[model samples]
Target: MTIGEAYLRIAEDRFRRVKGLGDGTFRQLSERDFYERTSQHGNSIAIIVQHLSGNMVSRWTDVMTSDGEKSFRNRDQEFEPADLPMDLILEQWEKGWETLFNALRNLTEEDLLKTIYIRSEGHMVLEAIERQMAHYAYHVGQIVYLGKEIKGGRWESLSIPKGSSDQYAEEMKRIHGKNGG
Candidate 1:
């Protein structure tokens, strides 16, 4: 693959993994737990997801041609608590990801070098992608941490389980050998 294509491939994989972490974490929480904050001033998963969805839609739609911060986006309102159903929240989450993936899928190699605007600031397309990837990853980490805190002893490992480094290493070695051959 070309460098640009390789970057997109890696980016798409990371985005998929991040979404999987979120889906797994959310599955462990009760509907009411989605709105529960770790602290009085902290944001709930609901608010975080809302902000993510709003950001994804704003940044990805017409990504190459228009400003990433859409005129219709009410970014400030995303922080406020809402009583929306859990299903709606999840739907919005999926919708945002879909928008992002669609935009990424349509990007040509040349598009990576193109300038994009976010709130009147110009950024290379690659830089914009990295910026959103980092932003989403940060929030997804928060979601996973809160879910683990709430689940406590009942929490499951999203990656390699604790105290299993040897087993994981062996598995990776085996897989690597197969691919190498």
Candidate 2:
């Protein structure tokens, strides 16, 4: 594959991996856990998901033509407590991801070099992708951390379980051979 094509694939895979982490955490949380706050000023998973969905919609819609920060997006409101139903929250989350994936799927290798505006500032399409990837990963990490804290002893490992590196490696080697390729 061409460099641009490879980059696009890698970017999509990375984003999917981040999303999967959040999904696993979500499966283990109760509906009430979505709205729980560890501190007075802390954001709940609900708020974080709302903010992410809002961001994804704003940034990915008409990405090549319009500024990422849309006029209608109330970023501040995304942080406020909404006490929304779980289904609605999940719907928003899915909508945001679908918007992002659609944008990525439509992009061409040549488009990666073109400029896109976020707010009033200019960023190359590739730069914008990287920026969003990092931002999303950060928030996903927060969600996972909070889920773990709330679940405490009941939490399951999203990745390799603690103190099992050797076992994990052996299993991988068995599946993928000694070189793991």
- Give per-residue CA lDDT, model 1, range 61-173, as digits (tens): 99999999999999999999968999999998999999999999999889998999999999999999999999999999999999999899999999999999999888887
TM-score (all chains, Cα) for each model: 0.96, 0.98
lDDT of 2: 0.96
Q: lDDT of model 2 at residue 172? A: 91
By summed lDDT, the worst window of 10 consecutive residues in model 2 runs over 82-91
lDDT of each: 0.94, 0.96
On lDDT, the leading prediction is 2
Across residues 42-131, which tens digit of lDDT does each residue of candidate 2 receive?
999999999999999999999999999999899999999967898899899999999999999999999999999998999999999999
